[model samples]
Target: MKRRPRRSVPALLSALVLLAACVLVAVSAIQRILGERAWIDYDTVAATLHNLHWTDLATAVAGSLLALAGVVLLLAAIVPGTATVLPLAGRFDSGVARGGYRTALRTAAAGVDGVSTARVRLGRRRIKVRIDTTRTRPDGLAETVRTAVADRLDRIGPATSPAVKVRVRAPRRTT
Candidate 1:
């Protein structure tokens, strides 16, 4: 089964804000209908709004902030979140989580001979591998790591195979 990306945080926040405003407005209206004191003094608010001028600094700032919030909410609604899982090639039954995939790639890199430690950062189309070794002249180590990572990737069989990039460094002592 395919996995969907998580919802945007900004979008959720905007929805919550709108819901709160609606609830507040409804409660005030209900209180007014009951002939009781409303939560908000509408008469006072109307008078204040009538006296407020566009040239006022407070009015300008409030308008700018509202416009900015609208733009942010619009962008949040339009942009899609990053995928959580990558689908496997020819397999509709399962997919791999990004964390698990990165861990597997790190294991493949570290399994190479002379690799003291391995670090991996994975992207949709790029796999970056960094390895530390003890040997001063770590010749062919990068290629070996790349090959091992590629082999592992083949076994996992992601729908899209990311290009493997390997960087090997020999440990050094600073005087």
Candidate 2:
């Protein structure tokens, strides 16, 4: 089974805060049970609770907010993180890091003659290559770039081969 990615920074920080709160509560409970000086004052807490009106709108709003926070934290922990790497075809588990595939595609496109520059974007189901060429006839340039990018992707043998879409643009003339 593939391991889930790490949680986001905010999720991790929230978890840490929750852990610390639990530890503090546990320590306080132990101290109170052992007749030692507890960090929290039980008398004050009881008095505050008795004074609060449970039916008040503020109490209801506070309770709702607390419930919503718990739900958000639970969702963060249960949901799988976003995928940042594309899986490669191989006997063992292998993946190409983000931007690696783009770089490879760009290099392959740039290797073609007359190509001044190449920009590539790799998506889940499509690969878009934008090429700036100095060649007069750009009619056939798109197909050529597409073929080159397709061949490069085939060589890499990723789990899913994205369809290649090539766009040829004329190079800007400099005075």
* Strongest candidate by lDDT: 1
C-alpha TM-scores of all predictions: 0.74, 0.59
The alpha-carbon root-mean-square deviation between model 2 and the true structure, to one decimal in Å, is: 5.0
Query: Lowest summed-lDDT stretch of 10 residues in model 2?
Result: 1-10
Q: After TM-score superposition, what is the CA distance of residue 51 in candidate 2 from its true location, in Å?
A: 4.1
lDDT (Cα, 0-100) at 97 in candidate 1:
92
lDDT of each: 0.86, 0.83
Off by over 4 Å in 2: 1-4, 19-51, 112-119, 130-138, 167-175
In model 1, what lDDT does residue 77 have?
Answer: 63
lDDT string, candidate 1, 1-175, tens digits: 3465755578688779999999999998899889999999778889999999999999999999999998877766677655678788883667989889889999989888899999998766898999999987887999999999999999999888989988888866544
Error of 1 at 9 (Å): 1.9
Model 2 local distance difference test score: 0.83
Overlapping backbone residue pairs in candidate 2 total 0
Residue 65 displacement in candidate 2 (angstroms): 3.3
